[model samples]
Target: MILLQANNVMRRFGADVLFHDVNLQIQEHGRTALVGRNGAGKTTLLKMIAGITSPDEGTIAKSKDLTIGYLAQDQGLDSQNTIWAELDLVFAPLHKMEKQIHQLEDQLASLDPSTRKFQLTTEKYSQLQADFKKRGGYEYESRMRGILKGFGFEEDDYQTAINSLSGGQKTKLALAKILLQSPDLLILDEPTNHLDMNVLAWLEDYLKSYQGALLVVSHDRYFLDRVVSDIYDLDNHTLRHYTGNYTQFMEHKQEWLTAEWKHYEQQQKKISKLEDFVNRNIVRASTTKRAQARRKQLEKMERLERPETDDKSIHFRFYSEKDSGNEVLDVEKAVVGYNDQKLAGPLSFTVRKPQRIGIIGPNGIGKSTLLKSILDRIPLVSGTIKLGANLQIGYYDQEQQQLHPEKSVLNEVWDDHPNIAEKDIRSLLGSFLFVGDDVYKLVHDLSGGEKARLELTKLSFKPINFLILDEPTNHLDIDSREVLENAINEFNGTVLFISHDRYFINQVATDVLDMNALGIKHYEGNYDNYLEAVNKEKATNANQDESQTTTTKPKKSSAQQSYQQSKETQRARRKLQRRVDKLEEEMTVLEEKQEAIKEQMSQPEIATDIGKLSDLQKKLDKFTTQSEDVELEWTSAAEELEKFDQENS
Candidate 1:
């Protein structure tokens, strides 16, 4: 069944048309995503479909009795009630039914058993009970609690006043409330803006099992890929439907664009030939009739317009003028905090040359604080942070605090590089999409995305070997984020950044630093690899626990048993240690071979020979596979040895 439909919708802002002839439908239990670049009228169209605003030239129709729960971008609750009380309002009808049932019970107790009034009251009470059960009255509180917990609210937080909560928390509460309402359709705009990885995972799972249709606008590609099955790409002031996840939609869109361009080009060539013939031969006496016939054909033909494309995005690459030492950064037993209070650590980690490390943890666990501590912008509570030689660091602040509010966009970059020509600076700013009058806009007047682009322009203006970025992808659209990823990959520099974008991390991070209140755990690969290793470790611990619990042997002398266990443990530790050492040696050899193959491939002479390149490429692939296998084996063996030592010690 169709839950909602927008037919021939047109929205306008005075003389400007945002989008026209937009059409789409939401079916029962549909999972749809609305995607586009920033400022592509996605939010505007969503408002019209959600009935928060009216379309200027079309109708939005919905199924009879349909209920919509629309969550605007960063929309928060403005309520004076306690958190629990606010959520409890969603079950007001059930509560009222419960109260009536209680009143009926009281009346029944006081009335005569044979009276019609008593019998009528009993029937009414039973009906109320059935209705309440059907409405999920018994499970409402539990369901609310589960959702609140998923949003990071503790039981103690239930009594907290809604007005006192932070903006992000209030937004979370708003989503939680809407979810509890369980409307016929849910419309969310950038719901993942304030969510961490853990909460994002939870929300994805919840929406997968949601009982209603969903229309969401999000820049989180990873979330969209997992939760949504249908995509409506709002581009060039129109919507195009594709029946698949975000990845599949991209593939289909690319194919469509290619076909559209080919057709347009073919039409353009035909028109050009006809026009040329008409222009050159119409004045000739011999070809007058032919020209007239060609003109008639041209007049009857429909011309194809140019294909539309989105090319107004920032483009730049990060490159280091000089290389840094192997040790880019070294943190030894570092504890990061504020006002002398410890937040996270004692942590120890070493960043080598050209290693892009992604720091991840819960919201308040001090991932950003650790970055500040390393840069000496904030003092570490204890321990040391050392930077390697020949290093120049560029930091991208998530808050855009580095920009001066009073400064023009042109001055923001030009002031930093006064030696450069003004025209050259303008050219550079134009590449970041700050052209003409936009270059003169005040920093404070620019949007979040504009500020982000301005900041990136500044970062790219200098030569740096180390990048320390905090939530770099926060304000960027998916396209811009992908561009940033490409720049990072192409750069010959070391990077240590904090981000909640799982897709961005997977694309750029060569390693992950999983921080906790206790310490930081190092993983040798991307986010998925970290998860796999963690799961494997948990399974190993579980198996060890089971083996210990299931062991049932006859009791032996205390001295003998102690001796035997100690001896056996020592032998096992030795064996594991030897295995670890052997794996480490094998890994080193494999890595060296891979590096050698890469060096050979990079040579100019070898690069020009197709046969030689192919043979070298095959060798490189084989060595790369071997290296990864050995690396995994080495990681496993080292972890086992570490666990054994900790337990047996």
Candidate 2:
């Protein structure tokens, strides 16, 4: 059953069209995700769907009885009510029913059992009891507790005033209330904003079992991978649906774009050949007739628009102008906090050259404090922080408080490096996606994402041997996060960073140090590998087994049989390589057809045919699925070939 539908929805701001001709449907119990780069109008479309705003044209039809709970990007509960009080309000209807039940009980006591009034009273009382049980009246407090606990709140904190809570705490309370309300359609914009990994995992499980449809907008790829089943991508002033989570959406989108680019390139080639022929032979007597005929055919042909690839992200490498010593940093028995307080005590760690160490912990656990201590912006209560010789530090503050709000984006970087030309500074800004008037925007006016990019722009140009980053991926979209990961991976220096982004840690961190108010626990691998190890240990303990091997099994083949195995590997490699070759050929043909359909869609005569347009969209979606599958198979085959060769050697 369809719960909500938007037909031909369009949203425009004066001359700028945000999105148009968008059509979507949310079915019962559907799990949909809205994703795009920042400022691509995802939140705007979400508002339209949630009825906070109306579309310029088209209709949004919702189920007559549908109840919705929408959580905006900056959700907060601002009231004098305590945490428990705020949450209890979600059960207001149940409270009213409870009051009615109480009154009925009193009336029943006064009425005679033999009267018709007594009989009717008993029937009503029984009906109310069943309704109360069905609506979870009995478990209301327990349910509230469960939700609060899942959001990293203790029972003791439940009665605390919401006004006294932090901004992030208020946001969590708001979300908890929405969850308890349990509306038919739950819409969240960036719901994963203030969630830590542990709370994030719990919320994922909580959302999975929810008896309602979900539409979410979040940048947490790992969380989305665990929750959403469908993706609604807002790009190029339109919404496109893909049948997968964030990772799968990325794969499908890349494949679709590849096919589209291929089509455009093929069309351009044909046009180039025809144009060359017309220019070369149009004036000649011998080939003039044929040239004129070619020109006419070219004019009749519909031109395919070039794929937009104007997305600008920072592209830079990190290298130390001077190499630091082998021991980049050393801290022993450190107590990190402000004044006389201790956030984490007896914390000892050493950072070596070229080691990318990721610091992870729950919110307000002094991860940032630790970094500040090392930078000497704050003092350590106990242990000494030693830096190796010839060291230069680059720090990225997550709050972006280090930036000068009064300065323009151009002047922010230019003031530091006065020797660099103004044009050069603009060029650098362009790499970070700050182009034209964007560079003139004041730092205070920049979005969180823009400020992050600007900070990165400054950090990259610095000749630093060690970097200390605090929640560096805080406001970055997935693409920018990946770009930062790439830069960090390639940097030939030591790095100690704090991040809640598990995907970013998995890609860049060589080691992870789990911090808390107590102390730290180190893991010697990526986030996924660390979790695997932890879970495996837990499973062993739960099974009451202490003898399970944590090490990987060795290869069975011996040195004596190496020659025979090498020959076998060669044959396998050849087979896999042949498969890759075949997939490439199929990809080319699919791409050409993709472009042909796009050209047809762009034709002015066919554009007005709604049925034809819908059919083309469906066809395009099919092509995307097929192209992704082929690409995946090809990648696997290529990897298999490489692995076989490496193993045989």
**Per-residue lDDT tens digits of candidate 2, residues 1-649?**
9999999999999999988888888989999998888888889999999999999999999999999999998698999998989889989989999999999999999999999999999999999989999999899999998999999999899789999988898898889999998999999999888888898989998998899999999988878877888998888778889997676788788898999999999999999999999999999999999999999999999999988742656677666788899999888888998896888877888899878899988888888889998989999978888988999899999889889999999999999999999999898889999998999999999989999999999998789899889988888887899899878866778999998887778667778998887788788866765776677767666675455445432334353144234434544554566577778878887888889999999999779999999999899889988988888988887887788768765
- Please give, for residues 1-649, the per-residue lDDT of candidate 1 as tens digits: 9999999999888999888889999999999999999988999998988898999998999999999999999999999999999999999999999898888888988999899988888898899999999999899999999999999999999999999999999999999999999999999999998888899999999999999999999999878877898999988888899987776688789999999999999998999999999999999999999999999999999887788966577899886788799989889999999998999889999999878999999988999889888888999999999999999899999989999999999998989899999999999998888989999999999999999999999999899899999999988998899899889876778999999998788777879999999899899876766766776677666666656535533455554355345545644765586578677778888889888988998999999999999999999899889888988988988898998888876
- Model 2 residue runs over 4 Å out of place are 271-302, 540-543, 547-649
Candidate 1 overall Cα lDDT vs. reference? 0.89
Report every candidate's CA lDDT.
0.89, 0.86
Q: List the candidate 1 regions with Cα displacement exceeding 4 Å.
A: 276-293, 544-649
On a 0 to 1 TM-score scale, where does candidate 1 land against the true structure? 0.83
Best by lDDT: 1
> What is the TM-score of each predicted model, taking all chains together?
0.83, 0.82
